[model samples]
Target: METTDFSQPIRQSAKGIIVIFAFNLVTFVKKFFVLFIAFGVSILRSKSIGNVTPTMMVLAVIGVLLIILIIAILKYLNFKFYLSKDDFHLATGIINKDNTIIPKSKIQNVYIKQNFLQQIINVVSVKIETAGDKKSEIEISALDKPTALLLKKKLFRKASSVSEELEQSESIEEPEVFFKVTPKRLLLEGLSQNHFKSFLLIFTFGFGLYSEFKDFLQELELEKHVEGLVELDEATILNLIITNVIILIGVVLISFLFSVVKTFIINFNLEVVEHQKTIEINKGLFNKVSLSLTPSRIQNLVITTNRVKQYFGLHTIAVKQAMVNVKQQKNFNIVALEKEQLDYLVNKLLSNYNDEQGDVAKPRPYFMRISALEMFLFGVVINGLSLAIFGIEMLWINAVFMPLAALYVYFAYKKAYYRISEDFVTIGSGVIDTTTNILEIHKIQSVKLKQTIFQRPRAIASLVISTASKSVTIPYISKSEAISIYNLLLYKVESQDRDWM
Candidate 1:
């Protein structure tokens, strides 16, 4: 294909107009929900009170719909995207146009999504992301599946010959399946999820709903009935307690069901397929998302397991790549499975992965003393303030909590450790919830050694290793140890020939 022909601008699929319109409508409603609701109520009241006719309300609705449709059409007409040899270019806008040129080398990942509507129409939405961009640089709302796949392949490989090779390989060989989620394992993972967090979310949601209901009742001048319940006799208080218990049970059941359904939908039929140089993930129910990950671009690997998951011998692995913005980092989850399966997948995906638990170096012994002292000081300050304001009656509560706080800090200090290998560095932290972060030594972008005034006397410092996506800090290590690790990492990064991104 000639460069000029391939670089020519092309519009999105025709159905994209509808998709864009729906997306814009939803966005507008979300941003101005309160204004929209108030305006709608005013219009409805006008009609009800004979200030406005039904015909007028109908006309207003039609006008708003027509405006939204026109905006969507204009957006569709303005959007154009194409690929050059070195850069992917996108031009879009209604009034003030935006031209974005993303270098092919900087492209981190390409995501393809198909919602229920897109599935019915046989089209997909493609998102092109780069390292520094918080949002996808280029988003084709709707494109024919074949065209989208071709564009994706060409953009990633940056060569027409590679596309041809991929096509030929697909015809000749099947991709190796690395791991897949079984229904039983999926159920176990869902059941073992953090129920306390789910309960908190449910509680917050219930409170918000109650607040909205109270406002609605007040709007209708019916809040007096609710306030009357506050003047409670013994029978009324007993009845209230029973009623609250029943309501709480219902809420908990609903929240649990929601959590299960959400987990199932998100991880439904999750599969990992390994190609020659990359891995492909396909999953989800209503909105199916497919992502391609290159091993060379991975920054760190985090394997996490809570107490409940540990009990079931399950672990969740999160793969962090070269993301410029922390908020935009999409930690690709390959699978949540048993330790054996997790180790197998990790070894396969990362050739340098070590299954052996190597000897880890702990912080200095004084680290625990420092941690306990800090916790004790904090507890004393908090207890002193409470005593001055609330009264000495609450002294017993502080007496119970201070020791617990100190114990937690002691455990946290004990859990913190670092292990450095010839090729990789592993840092483990956290108390009740443990997380281990592993990063290839050569991929480190920078290193820093820090010391505070208190630590200066002890000759202890903190070492921070920064990669493209995130940083890992080992605190309260000996200054000499921190300097040695820093120099070693810098030397490794400088000596490597591989690209960090």
Candidate 2:
């Protein structure tokens, strides 16, 4: 009997047709959404159009969908993939067939995910990412859970001799899970989140949605009823305060609910598992996500916390990997972890994990000056808006908010510091939610120096240091100090023989 060879070409699941069809259909609609809306409005306004009734419009949409489905079928039929000992191969495209060959040594990560649609369809997606060319990432959109797992394991293992590989099938060891999020900790993390940011996000989104329905609400006379409830024109100072307090309370409640629900859906059952040479993250509720990462691939370990989170013994950790697509993917976060758990993970990932600090250096007072001016401008805009919209009765808001905002700026300035140690440089910023980013000197890829006209006169500059994963900026530092640090970082990078990846 002959052993089955993976080098032979294989097709993805037939249900890939459905996934491709759905993807293409959504893309098509999004591409022409505004045009379609405009056309529909014109059709409705015109009384002379004979063949453009609502039923006809629906049929037209159906015809477009059918055409998209045909294209998806052709694309799915043309797709083929295979694995060789040294490389992986993919053949795709309908009208123009593309053959892509990727080296096995260059494979960075493999992610398995199931979105809402895929969950309903009972299929999963496998994403194979390389260190370069994010556009070339390979995705198998529709595979059964078992097949996807088998494929992932096969792709992730080290190469072996033909006979040895054949005999050693199912050779991978089980991963040890070192960290998991508990329900109680998750709740505490949600409660300690920056709800002001959530409130702002909700306000921005709601304002945009309200703009779309502004005229409709006016037509229904709902705006007048709301105005009557508030009595903006004739209300006394006490009444005004009561209305504002009620509105503020309502917004606070909504923001709190949004943050808690969002946290649960995103981080439910989050766990970190370890293998011999890699780490795996499994998380998400409605949309399940599994990520595999190598220690050498990680570039940044960022930890964030506020006073409330500190009291709850919680921190949010974000892992930044080399060559990962930030725009296409969400940040890899391990939420609601303790200090000890974080230290273990950091030491495991980063070999030179030193928590010692030499000297905490601050940017010159010019940074404070800039921040104050910016805050002043913000105050002007906010107070101006309040005065214009709500009359002089709202002028007291600045007396209440400005002092608190100024104190926040002062705290942020006090928090901003950079400490360079033997092998790492720590950058700290933020007041309400303090975020610390640790960067290794050996991994520094490039260093940039910049100076504005105002900064140059004062011998001040901004130092921008970039690693394989991300960049960090140290602004409003002395020009000579920035240059000295820049030179030191470059020298360390050159002296080290370590691979940044």
lDDT string for model 2 (99-156, tens) is: 9998766777888998888988899999888878778799989888887887776676
Name the best candidate (by TM-score). Answer: 2
* TM-score result, candidate 2: 0.86
Question: What lDDT would each prediction earn against the true structure?
Answer: 0.79, 0.82
| TM-scores for candidates 1 onward, in order | 0.81, 0.86
Candidate 2: C-alpha RMSD to true structure equals 4.4
RMSD of each: 5.4, 4.4
lDDT of 1: 0.79
Position 340, candidate 1: lDDT: 88
